[model samples]
Target chain A: MNNLAVDLPGLQLKNPIMPASGCFGFGREYSEFYDLSKLGAIMMKAATGSERFGNATPRVAETASGMLNAIGLQNPGVESIIETEVSYLANYELPIIANIAGSSIEEYEKVAAAFNETDHVHALELNISCPNVKEGGIQFGTDPKMAANVTERVKKASNLPVYVKLSPNVSDIVAMATAVEAAGADGLSMINTLTGMQIHLPSKRPLLANQTGGLSGAAIKPVAIRMIYEVKQQVSIPIIGMGGITTSEDVLEFLLAGASAVAVGTANFQNPFICPELIDALPHTLKKYGFNTVQDAIGKGITV
Target chain B: MKKETMRIKSTKRIALDTVEMVLENNYMSQTAVPGQFLHLLVSGHTLRRPISIADVNKTEHTITILFKMLGSGTHDLASYQVGMTIDALGPSGNGFQLHNDNQSTILLIGGGIGVPPLYYLGKTLAQLDMHIISVLGFQTSKSVFYEEKFRALGETYIVTDDGSYGDQGFVTDVLHSVESFDRYYSCGPVPMLQAVTASLKDKPGYISLEERMGCGVGACFACVIPTDDAGGYKKICKDGPVFDAQEVSL
Candidate 1:
């Protein structure tokens, strides 16, 4: 058997296939389709400091090879997640990564501390980089200093391994990644959705209610690869590469580009069975590429 | 919902832009309810298009779905013919709540492509020996379909905006002419739903909303609608494509 196991910071995954946060909702939704325990890890949806209703109608619009979303961290609060979502997710014997977002550093600390008390949660993914929200999201991610500050605060508040999910909407993605790593982030999630907008030609107005949304899917795959490649070179911390990964080949590409693990985003919308499909196909794909272990393939495409 | 590989038995253009597809899937035909929709995986399309179950014939083991060629996905769906196998995940969403013993009249109001799901609903209600009155609206006479099928089931009314078919106005216009109904079921664009909800404020009614979705299974919060609930929002894919008209804020 090919070794698909990956030890990402504090947590060890059966394989490197995990669904991106906001794509997988507590793993129960997809559990109806297949066994959730088969997955390497379940990345819970973004849980804010308080319950958020999210953005208005027309939150998503399709673009060529991709889609845009302005969901704005629509989730039950951290307390609710700990009380409800966490207990529900505990039924599955899989590593659960609590993805938390906040409007301020204190909120981030509070959520991280709360999640730290939870037993089922294996790690915390600090979402300092969601572009859809108005108050707290992408602001911290774009700037290295603010990103470092939030990362430092959240890392201090929690005993669990914290992974900073970086934004691709910045001028220097490497700087942001490095900042988070320096701020004591145990790991890094390279490339959140790119900021984009679509206009309705007939109405002469923006398609999304938020006017702007984060672009994700096949269209942004190349961008994700570039960012992961850059960040992996700059920082020693492990990276979870995700953007528009769909096929097993895409997973191999991200792995080669130095993603210790890969998260499937918009592809989940296209196919709900994607995580398992990718997992099943990974062995064959790696064999075809003449690789013996998943670790051997990691950073193989990079010169460093 | 089960993911079934269904073979298309036939495809016919019922209207100018509308096409009726019959698939030989016994599983879906048996499990499908009135308000539930199927998520079809079209070739070359990234996201599956959520198409409502228009009619299901258990004896024939066939499921009929009506789709309008609005975009590339539907345009590609139009090219599919008999013998082609299509991947479909369905019988999803909470369907309309049917009152079996309620002797009061039930109003089924639909607009455009929204009119198809009502046909199956009307059929189900008819089987229960309930009174079903359907008010269907279309943009023009060319867009009108399933009128005969609905008419054969129960008291059916059709209206066209261009006045080429039945009544010369919206479905609500015909609804206004009707004296009363015990309950109302609606599926249409936002404007029509708003008008119908306003007109039937005092009555108990249900409305099925259509939104551009990500995952048709409620994981992605793409197809969420604001509701008069604690969560403040409900997923149109899961919590409902069909919701109590009064419960959801239009």
Candidate 2:
């Protein structure tokens, strides 16, 4: 058997197949289907400083190849996560990535600092790329300076590794990657959902109550590959590539395009067996490509 | 959640836009209950579509699902052949709470696609010796379905918007006439659920809600419904697709 272990900046995993935040809750929902300990890591849903109920009803809209969601980062606050969620997750022998986002830098630092106190948490995924909320989410993500500022604050506050999850809505994603890297982000999680909107013809209004949302699914794979390739050239930090990755081949595509790890985001909604299936398929895929280890596939597409 | 390759036993067009499909799955038939749903993976769709289990024949190991061709996913599901196999993940969600009280009368209300699960609920309750009163509403006469099936279990009331068949108005019209309903179970559009909640304020009611879900598990917060408490959200997929009527804000 080949070594599928992925060593990110401050975290190591048995494999590189983990569910993206917002798709996998605190890990209980998917645990019913299969044991979650088989994957690389579990990124808990994005939590805020305080509990958020999120937007009103009609928060999701199905698109041609993907779905649009304006979940508004509804969660049970950081305290609840540490006390209730993160503790329960401790039963499983798996790495946990606490995906944190807030409306302000202080809010971001507050959540990060809280997670930093917990030994159960392996890393903190700074979610500056969420496009659903009215404040602090995508605003910091779209601007390089603001993105760097949030990353800097989080890195200083948290003892755990900080991976800044970048948004795909910006015109120059490479610029965003570079900014966060320069600001001392430990690692990077690329390609958060793109901004999108859908409408119901009968009512002639938006399908989601939030009016616009973040689009994620197989439709965004090509774009994710492009951006990961672009950012891989600009930054030396290990990039965790996501957005529309469904298959082992898709994971290989991201790795070859320069992702150190690949996350199964929207695909988990389609198939609960995805992460395990991909993990099981990776060995055969590596052999098919004449590669011995997962590390060999990284940046295989980039040439001097 | 159990994943099974269930064979389609039969498919019949029961109404204008709705199709009733009975799938043969031994384990699911033995386990499924009312208010629970099945997440079906259509061959080409990226997300699984959550469909309610309309009926279950435990003896035959068959589960019936009623769905309308509202989108490409259901459209693809509508095209399945009898011998064809499809992947199903289910008997999921907290289904209707079936209490042990036997002497009290039970009321069930459903609208459109929401009517399916009520059939299963009524059937389950009937077996327990509970008197089931069902009020099923549709947009018009042509869309009405399962009247005979629901009638077999108990006293069934049918209402339509255009008065083409049964009562001349909404389910609320018939609901006003019926008294002494001890327990209430409802599943339908949000408006229908809201109206039902308003009428049954004095009774213990459980409402099954519908939302566009990403993962039909508690994982994705896509199918959240705001509750009466501030910043408190209940997941329709996990905490409920079935919620206490008084607890939900709608």
Candidate 3:
């Protein structure tokens, strides 16, 4: 009886693998590669109060075992997303988590409230940690008070569970986690990409058009595990860990570090079938580690 | 849009720093169309490099890709030998839309590495019995390739930045010399594409674009170009690597 299922605040996942927001893009494109129902949930691309063109061209640059992107939350406003993207995803049997982002608290509330119209969206991943945006993203994420304030407002606006995505750029990951948790965040999704840049030698300038972008890949895994371990001890809410997850072993490491489930990010670009692949491999890996189920493995690696 | 582990049937240098590698994959060779690209995963690299399909041979069960050693990833790809297998996501992107209507005469404008897909396009058009003409531009004679292949199809001209080749100038410089063309297709750097578009503003044309891509799929909006209408943008990976001449702003 190998059980891969894990229950989070608002998500009843069949397995512990889901595609991270921004990387999955509403589940339309990847739906071509594999069945959407095979995964536990789908974390959609960040949606705002209005449409955003995001950053200019040369938006992504490759680094060692990782990549940098300043996509700046490019999305077709929440209204359009609800009218089309969300409704389209409703056809899937799995849970749909809507990731909401904005330039202000009011915009966050508006975008959060907008998801109430869709019956298919089971949760809301509050994206206060998006490193690419200028005004709202990291500004809210880095400051404890601001992170709590946005969490509180969004919690009031939406019926779905709110999961605050923490940024690794902050000095104290636990402080940001506790603040959001106290403000009523149902769970935590850490860590959003670490702010980094790559310099192109020939051009004698930054590689990404936005100059600096969030770095995510194998290079950020250890940091993610450390943060999840630290924050899990300080906060009581479940943690949906992501950052440099590419293999089933990475998923188990995250679970042991106290993540309830895991999200696949940059690895989706490397292999579109990564989610299902991880889902299939997780049970065997868990058993090899002496765990009967995914839930049994959570926090096993953390010390009091 | 199939993912397959394609084996390299042969690998050789075609021009200066460019390498031509033919990969044997039955599904890809049979399904790939002109201007479609292969998002190949090179060992020791994070992101998969998107290389356009240079040509396809259904009978041989192989698809050819020509790439220049641009950086560490491509340089590593150039090192791969025959019989090696590479993971590929392919026939990706919206390829060129071919029509055998009254637009029988076609002009192909290519610059450097962008010349590969045009070769595939020229080959496909030639099979349709369409009259083809190609104007290829390179940095020098050493960088020029496929001149004879294009000439076998129809009238072909080679232009180089340095006066070591056919004509000393840009492709736009020789545009007026070609008698006439009912339609044109181009793939090159932004400046060259812009110049070609401006010179042939009234002509029906399609241009392939290049951008730094994340997931060579529509999932990531990394490779987007602004639409001409100024309303929104289109993804270069999904909406097109190929677009109508007047569709996108350079």
Candidate 4:
């Protein structure tokens, strides 16, 4: 039996491994690497109300065991994504989750409502946590009231289940998680990239064109696990955990820390085959840890 | 487009802070084109370093990469011994388009590390019997490599910032002396590319660009450059590491 299959709200994943949003880019680039069907689910890039050109050049900086990116939610807006990108993804058999972001509550609602017309989109990953964008993004994620307001409005506007991606730059992660859950969030994608910066010695200035970028990679794994562990005990909704997930062992660690499913982010850049490789390795790794199924391992490490 | 573990066949310092590495991989050697690059994984670094393909020998099943030891990632790549294998994904990005008119003259402009890809392009064009003229620039004489090889192909000019070798000044100084060419191709730093594009604005040409990238594939959107078209931008990793000289904003 394939013990890798996982079920989250509005998503029946073949496995617990999927490429995180922003990292996968609408599944077009990675489709050249391997079969998209091999993935558990596809988290499409963040779509706003209109086109976004994002940050200037030198948007990425490499750090130890990780990388920082200030991509600023660059996308072709919701309508174009639905007509071009989403329609292209509809050819695949797996579920597709649209990651929606915007500068204001009205824009978030408009983007969320727009996804309801798409035939293949199964859920919406509310991206109030993108640290790179200056106008919106992390501002909502860091505040509980703003986070819930966006969540409630998006939930009201869209027919699909909403998964609020939480930012780690907050003073209270549990409060942020519970607030969204109370506001009708069906699930949670916890621990978005931590805010970070790198210095270029020769230039004697910040490395990224944007002063700071969101940090993602193996360096943030422990932080993801800690947040998931804390939020799992407080909320009834499922958690889709991600942060520096690279290996099957890392997947199991996220599952053990209370993530119902895992998303591979920065590691996908390191190896394009990471998501499918993790899917193939998950069953064996699960057996090695004595778990018969993915559901059995969720929150196993969290004590009541 | 494919990921494979390519074995290091040889490694040697070709210039100041520059090392030439020849990696053995039948797939890459065959598929790699003139301006495409190899995204190499150096041990202990999360992101891979993208180095341009300097040469390819399909019969030997090897592709040569020339890069400067700029940071820890590239510094680690320079340390690998012969026979050791390193993971690489590539022959990535759009390569330079070759014009096959035998009677036409083509000019090649390259600066610093950017000079590597032009070597492969020059070699390809030389075989087609097209007239090739190369103007290569460096910081000093010590940083220059492939002067003799380029000279073997066609009329080659060398320039340095400090008058250490050949002409003293940028490649633009020599561009005027070359007289005329049907087309031009360039790969270098952005400022150098901008200057080259400006000087050769009347002639049709292609320019390969470089930027800090996350996913060497198009997914990350980390290496995008603005275009004059309605799409507003193009990903340097996917749409091109190479673009029409007149298309991009610079």
Which DockQ value does candidate 2 get?
A: 0.78
Error of 4 at A38 (Å): 1.4
lDDT values, one for every candidate = 0.89, 0.89, 0.93, 0.92
| A112-149: candidate 1 lDDT, tens digit per residue | 99999989899999898899989987889888999899
Worst 10 residues of 4 chain A by lDDT: A1-10
Best by DockQ: 3
Alpha-carbon deviation at A189 in model 3, angstroms: 0.3
lDDT of 4 by residue, A1-304 (tens): 6677778889998888888999989999889988898888999999999999898879999998899999988899999999999999988888999999999999999999999987799999999999998899989998999999999999999889999999999989999999999999999998799999999999999999998998999999999999999999999999999999988999999999999998888998889999888888888898999999999999999887
B1-250 per-residue lDDT for model 2 (tens digits):
6888889999989998899999999989999988899889898887788999989999999999999998878999999989999898888899999999986799999998899999888988988889989999998999999999889988899999899989888888899887678899999988898888897788899999888887887788888777866666688888888888987788
DockQ computed for model 4 against the true two-chain complex using alpha carbons: 0.86
Q: Where does candidate 1 clash, by residue pair?
A: none
- The predicted structure with the larger DockQ, 2 or 3, is 3
What DockQ class does candidate 1 belong to? medium
Model 2 gets an lDDT of 0.89
lDDT string, candidate 3, B48-114, tens digits: 9999999999999999999999899999999999999999999899999889764389999999999
RMSD of candidates 1 onward, in order: 1.5, 1.5, 1.0, 1.0
For A1-304, candidate 3 gives per-residue lDDT tens digits of 5399888887999998999999989889998989998989999999999989898879999998899999989999999999999889888889999999999999999999989767889999999999999999889999999999999999999889999999999899888999999999999999999999889999999988999999999999999999999998998899999989988999999999999999999999999999999988888898898999999999999878
Report the number of clashing residue pairs per model: 0, 1, 0, 1
Per residue, candidate 4 scores C-alpha lDDT tens digits across B1-250 of 7999999999999999999999999899999999999998899999988888999999999999999999999889989999999999998999999977886899999999999999999999999998899999999999999999999989999999999999999998999999689999999988999999998899999999999988999998999998865658989988889999998898
